[model samples]
Each structure stands twice: as C-alpha cells, then as structure tokens.
Target: MIISNIAAPLLGLVDTAIIGHLPQSIYLSGVALGAMITSFTYLLCMFLRMTTTAEIAHAFGARRSDLAQQTTTHAVVIAAVLGLAIILLRPVILQLAWAVIEPDPELQRYASQYIDIRLWAAPAALINLVVLGILLGRQQAKYAMGLVIFTNAVNVVADIILIIGLDLNVVGAAWASVLAETSTAALGLWLIRDLLPPWRQWHITPAYFKQFGAMNRDVFIRSLLLQFCMAVMTGYAARFGAVTVAANAVLMQFLMLISLGLDGIAYAIEALLGAARGQGSRHKIRLWMRLCALWSLLFACAYSVVFWGFGDGIIRLLTDLPEVIQTAKLYLPWLIIMPLLGHWSYYFDGVYIGLGLTRAMRNTMAISVLGVFVPTWLISQQWLAEEHANHGLWLALSLFLLARGVTQWFYLKRHQRRLST
Candidate 1:
C-alpha cells in the first residue's frame, strides 16, 4: 500500500520532469495547469472509491459474495456515469477552472490542448478508482500494487515515446496519461473478472442508488471540505507574498508526504475494520484497532523525526530559492509536529469508513472546518500582526486536523456501547 501510494505521486514528478525538458517553459506551465484541473475534479469524486471500498469490505466480512459482486457493479456504473458527465461538461469545467486561474493566452492554449486530450480518458480514470476499491476491499494487496505499477509503467513509457521520440510536446504528455488510464482501466476489469456480475444476474435498483447516495453524501462533503481548506490555505498564504506562498507550497508537499504514508495504513485499516464490523466481530474490530494504532503511531513518530532532523534539507532539495527555503523553515516546526496531532484523524477516518459511519465523519468535519478552523484563523488575522498572520493560519490548520481526530474520537466513544453490542 505504501509503495503504491508513493509510486502514485512519482508519476506527477516524472511528468513534470518530462515536460521540463522542453525548450520553452510554456509547455511545462500548460501541462501543470491542466493537471491541476485533473486533480481537483478527481478529488471531488474520490468518495466513490472510499464508499465502494467500504461496501466491498463489509460484504466480504459478512460472507456475502453476492453483495460484494453487486457493490463492484454499482461502483463501476456510477464511475462510468460520472466520468461521462465530466466529458460532456468539459467546456463548462474549463471555463470555470480558467476563470479562477486566468493564465495568459499562450499558456491557456497549451493547457486547453492538454485538457481536451486528457478528457478522453475521464471514464477510464474514474472507473479505475472503483477497480482499486474492489481490489483493496478484497484484501488483494498484491493485485492493487501490481495495477498501480502497471499504470505508472505504461505512463512512463508513453511519456518517453510520444514526448521524446515523436516530439508531441505537451500533447504527448496528455496522451500518455490518457493511454495509461484507459489501458489500466481495461486491465483492472480483466483482473477483477471473477467479481464482475454476469449479464443476467446484474441488478442496479433505485434502492441501491438511494442507499449509495446516502452513504456517500457525507464522504463527498468531507472531500469538498478538505479541498476547500487546501484552497483556503493556499489563498491565505498568498497574502504574505510570493516567497511565503512558495514556502507554503513546499510545506504543503511535506504534509502530502505525511498523509500519503499514513493513508496507506488507513487503507488497510478500512478493509480490516470494515470486514470486522460487517461480521459484528467485536473482538476482531478491537484487535484491528489496537494493532493499527500501534503501527500508525510508530509511522507517525518516524515522520516527525525525519522532519525534525532533515526538514530544512528537504526544503533545499525541493527548491534552490534561498528566500523560500528560509521562510519555509520559520514554519517547519508545525510540519514536524503535524504528524503527531494529525495521525488521529487519518486513523479515525479508517475506523469510520469501515463501520460505514460517514455521517459522523461529516458532522465532525463540519465542526472542525466551520466551528474550529475558520474561527481560529479569522480571530488570528485580527489578533496577530501581519508578520505573524501566517502563523495563525498554520495554527488554525493544525488545530483543524487535531479537531477532526478529537471529535471522531468522541463519536466512537459515544457509540461504543452500541458498536460493541
């Protein structure tokens, strides 16, 4: 899981490197802009993956092969529909995305070309999410790992061949991703052939949609909240000027690294806990919780130590700008300790997803985002000097994460009696 998570991000780095080799900087900027849109739209739809994983895991735990099969079918259908919707709405999406971004005409042209090409694989990319969810839910870690590697491998090769060999430039980079996603989706379907429902047996009723929508509503909100907070952080950081914003970007990468490593563990927990909860096995659920906590804590501690020891060095490696590096160091402490405070939310997230208690997650996130994080930052802007305004922003974010974990903890405790029974 960790390797797959880590490998996923490396694809972006590779893409950037490939595009960076171009003589003109516009190619890189264009691809970057298009990729940002890809990230945002896909992010909003991530709930499909989590909800599907939960459904499959629960069904598996309960020994309901029929339910598991149905879950996969349902997810594939929804992913297809959503992906198609994205394709059809591509024009509107581009206009909306560009409105906020507002890049130059030349860069916009390059990015639009990339986006137009990339949208061709929207259906495949979205379906791949459910395919992965199915694989992970079955605890087929090796298969999941292999699929990720396969996709990345295809992408890397295509990027080299089309971008370098054919000199397709930005278009080649876009096509690489499209090819990778489309081919991987096909491979994923083949890999999960056993789980696919037969034509005569397939059924997707309104009840399924209703239940699925209910299950995913909170998850969707959670994704949106996370995205909003990220945008808010970036927007707020921009207030301090280019150097501070750049530093925040660098620091944000650190947070992403932390989340990626921890999320690998969370995924495992989701599967384990979901299966256990499905079976109503209190003992198994308790055991998984205790075991996951120990390991996740160990991993979180390692992140803190690495950041504490080499945070500045990592910053320097990311950029040669001394000002950005220096500014980033000023807030490095928050990044260093963030793992300790932030791991709980990630941990509890797995728990909630496994138990299929997204409403709890939704409520806690609302409180964390609106009740705690926003208020803290708003107060800080007025209370703290301009020089230290970013400090308050950091403080709000840290507290926001901590608040999520804490609130979820309370949720678990509040319902412990019912759950254990």
Candidate 2:
C-alpha cells in the first residue's frame, strides 16, 4: 500500500521536476494551477474509489462476490457519467476557475494547454479509481500496487520522451498523462479478469443504484470540500505572482508526497477495518486502529525529520531556478511539520470509510474547510503582509488538518460504546 501510494504522488513530482526546470516559471505555475483545476473536476468522483473500497471490502469479508461485482458496475457507470459531464462542461469549469484564480495570461495559457488535453482522460482516470478500489477491497495489495506502478512508470517515460526529446512543453506533459491514464485503465480492467464476470451476468438494478448513491453521497461532498480547500491554496499562491506560484507548485508536490504516503496507511486501515466490521470483530477493528495510528505517527515523524534535514537538497533536485528555489526554501517550516499536522485527518478518513461512518467524516470536513480553513486564512490575511501571505495559507491548511482529527476523535468517542460493544 505504501509503495503504491507513494508512486501515485511521484507522478506529480515528475511533472513538477520536468516543468519546473523550463526557462520560465510560468510553465510550472500553469501546470500547477491547471492540475488544481483538473483535480477539482476529476477527483470530484473520488467517492467512486473510497466507497467502492469500503463496500467491496465489507462484501469481500462477508464472501459476497455478487455484491462486489454489482458495486463495481455501479461505480463504473457513475464514473462514466461524471467524466462525460466534465468533458462537456469543461469550458464553464475553466471560466469559474479563472474567476477565482485570475491567473495572468501567460500562466493561464500554459494552464489551458495542460487542462485542454488532460481532461479527455476524465473517464479513464475515474474508471481507474474504481479499478484500484476493487483491487484494494479484495486485499489484493500486490496487484493494486502493481497497477499504480505500471501507470506511473508509463507516465514517467512518456514525460521524458515528449518534454525532453520532442520539446512539447506542457502539452507534452498533459498528453503523457492522458496516454498513461487511458492505457492503465485498460490494463486494470484486464488484470481483474478473475473478478470480471461475463457480459450477460453484469446487471444493475434499481436497488443497487440507491445503495451505491447512498454509499457515495457523504464522501462525494467530502472530496469536493477537500479539493476546494486545495484549489484555494493554489489560487491564493498564484496571487503572489508566477515565481511564488511556481515555488508553491514545487512545494505542493512534496505536500502531495506526504499526504499520499500517509494515505497508504489510511488505505490499509480502510480495508482492514471493513473486513473486521464484516466479521463482527471489534477486537480486530480496534487492534488495526491502534496499529494504524502508531505506524502513521512514526511515518509522520520520519517525514518531518527528513524535510527538516534534506528538504533543501530535495527542493534543488526538483527545480534549479534560483528565485523559485530561494522562495520555496523560505517556507520549509510548513512542509517540515505538514505530515505531523496532517496525518491524522488522512488516517481517520480511512477509519470512517471502513466503519461506514462517512457522514461523520463529511461533517468534520465541513467544519474543517468551511469553519476552520477559510476563516483562519481570511483572518490571518488581515494581519499578514503580502510577502508572507503564503505562510498564512499554510497555517490555515495546517489548522484545518488538525481540526479534522480533533472533531473526528470526539465523534468516535461519542460512539465508542455502540461501536465497541
């Protein structure tokens, strides 16, 4: 799970690495802002993966192959609809992002170059989510990890050939992602042959639709709120100019690395807890919970130490631009403590998914994003100078993460008697 999770973020880092070295910072900034918009649009269907994993894990534990098949079919359909919706409404989406981000013309052009080509894979990307969800739900971590490794491996090679050899710039990066996503989705579907039934056997009933939607509803909103917060962070960073946004782009890749690496812990617990729930073993559930928390804390501490020690070296590896490098190092403290501050939210998100407590998950995220994140950033803005505004953004983001864990902990405490008994 950790290897798989880490590979996913390396895709972003690779994009950052290649684009960050271009003659101008706008290329990196464009992709940064463009990727933010892409994430916002495509990851809206993130619930396809989350709910699919939990529900399928529970079904797997209960030995319900039929249910798992049905869940996968439903997720595929939902993904198709949402992906198509994105492709159709992309212009409107871009307009909305422009209103909020107000990126300069050159940055916007680079961003548009990325966005226009990248979004064509919306269906493929979302389907891959379901493919991964199904793989993880069955506790087939090796295969799940293999799929991601294959995808990113393909992406890396394509990035090198197009960006370096062909000089396609941001368009090259975008195309590389498209090819990777579409091909990986195909490979994933084929690899799940054991789970895939005959065409005649696949059918979705009304009950399945209702159940799927119910499972997806809360987590759907949670994914959106989370993405919105990130988009806000990137959008605000863009306000500081191309150099600042480019520095942020590089820093955000590291942040993605931290978040996704910890997410491996979350993914593990999600599967383990769902299986425990299905088997009606509170002991196993609580046991996995404790272990997940302990391991995650250790991992978080290691990240903080690593960033504190070697972060500058890693930053230099990503981009050689003197201005961007200096600017990125200016905010090293936030990246250093980010894992420690943010790991809990990522961990508990898995707990909620596994326990079928996604409503509570959504509630905490609502409080974190709407109640804590935006307000903290807004309030800090009044006192923060323009040069230090990014710091304020990081502070709000850190507090938002802290607030999620705190609220989710209280909710779990309130329900402990029922849950444990």
Instruction: Report RMSD (Å) for each prediction in the order shown.
Output: 3.3, 1.3
**Taking the tens digit of each residue's C-alpha lDDT, what string does model 1 give over 153-242?**
999999999999999988998899888889989999999999887878777878877898888788999988876676556545545664
The TM-score values for the models, in the order shown, are: 0.86, 0.97
Clashes of 2: 0
Poorest lDDT segment (10 consecutive residues) of candidate 1: 4-13
lDDT of the candidates, in the order given: 0.81, 0.86
Per-residue alpha-carbon lDDT of model 2 for 103-176, expressed as tens digits? 88888988988998888998888888888888888889999889888989999999999998999989998998
The reply for model 1, stretches above 4 Å from the true place, is: 6-8, 16-34, 98-117, 159-173, 199-201, 235-247, 316-331, 378-393, 418-421
